[model samples]
Target: MFTHRIDSATYLKLLEVQDSEKLFQLIDSSREHLRNWLPWVDKNTTVEDSRQFIQHTLDQFAAGNGFNAGIWYQGALAGVIGFHKIDWQNSTTSIGYWLGEDYTGNGIMQKAVSKCLDYAFLELRLNRVEIRSAIGNVRSRRIPEKLGFTLEGTIRQAEKLVYGYVNHNVYGMLLEEWEAKENSSTYDDETYE
Candidate 1:
């Protein structure tokens, strides 16, 4: 696994044991901010639960199912972003992420997502990636949009939140599309200058 360091912040491949403490910190720090979007936080799950979760993620990574990268900002654990429910046969994957409340709106998540997407498309050879945001989650929805993902559609009551089932807006981006955008942007910049 590759450990990526950007702007002095490292994105390390998560370990089951060594990473558990940081995972707990992330959970505790984001509890209030996450409660509205993620129901799992409402359970008030323990650090042991995070250990189990880390174990599951590591197992999945080992089995070639998916990969989760821990985001460290300024040498402290800040959040996590991952490719889950990976379908290699279908050339597709889903991207999920969360950040500590304090790190919100600082472009850290954007950088993390960009790095993960590069890994997925270039290293893993994935064709497409998807991001689903709960309806009305402006901040969450903006991630995919900022990355040039196309809004595919909305799934009504697609996810069950703490309150109840809620609609989700599905966004998708293809590797080819990303590459084209990358190339075009370079040309556009040259032309503008």
Candidate 2:
């Protein structure tokens, strides 16, 4: 996987042990914010927990299933974004992302996801990309919408969160849709950069 850089910010590679401490600190500090939507936070109580997650991600990438990347904004470890899994037979993948509370509203995630879409369609040659956001998570769902993904449908009670089952709005974009967006007269050149 290549470092997806946008202007001065770089989405750095996440690896086992290498970034476990910083990753754990960010998770610990933002436990309240992240745990609200993410179910894995409570399980990530120690640096060893993060190392385990990183190791899984590393093995996932090595197996060509997918990979995760740390969003490095300016000079700090801000958050993470990556493909959840690559369904090669279907030529499809699902994207998941989260930014540290402090990094939200800075257009960092929007750019990071756009670049991920480009890599999925252009580099990986995947036909379809999906982003499923828990219903009412307006901020998290907006990235796919802003990128022109079609509102596929809602997967009611799709996820069993810590609280209860949460509905998910599934957003999808095909390679054709992405290409059309790329060739549109009003296309923003910076989007896929």
The lDDT of each candidate is 0.79, 0.85
Q: Best candidate per TM-score, number?
A: 2
Worst 10 residues of 2 by lDDT: 184-193
Model 1: lDDT equals: 0.79
Per-model TM-score on C-alpha atoms: 0.90, 0.92
- Which lDDT value does model 2 have at 97? 91
| Candidate 1 off by > 4 Å | 10-12, 183-193
Best by lDDT: 2
| Span of 10 residues, lowest total lDDT, candidate 1 | 184-193
Cα lDDT tens digits, model 2, 73-120, are: 888888998899999999999999988888787777777887888899
lDDT of 2: 0.85
Q: What TM-score should be assigned to candidate 2?
A: 0.92
lDDT of 1 at 169: 98
- Cα lDDT tens digits, model 1, 1-193, are 6477655654655655677877887888789888888877756478888887888888888888887778888878888888877997999999998888887777777667777777788888899999999987788887888778899999999888877898999999899987787655321212110
lDDT of model 2 at residue 152?
A: 94
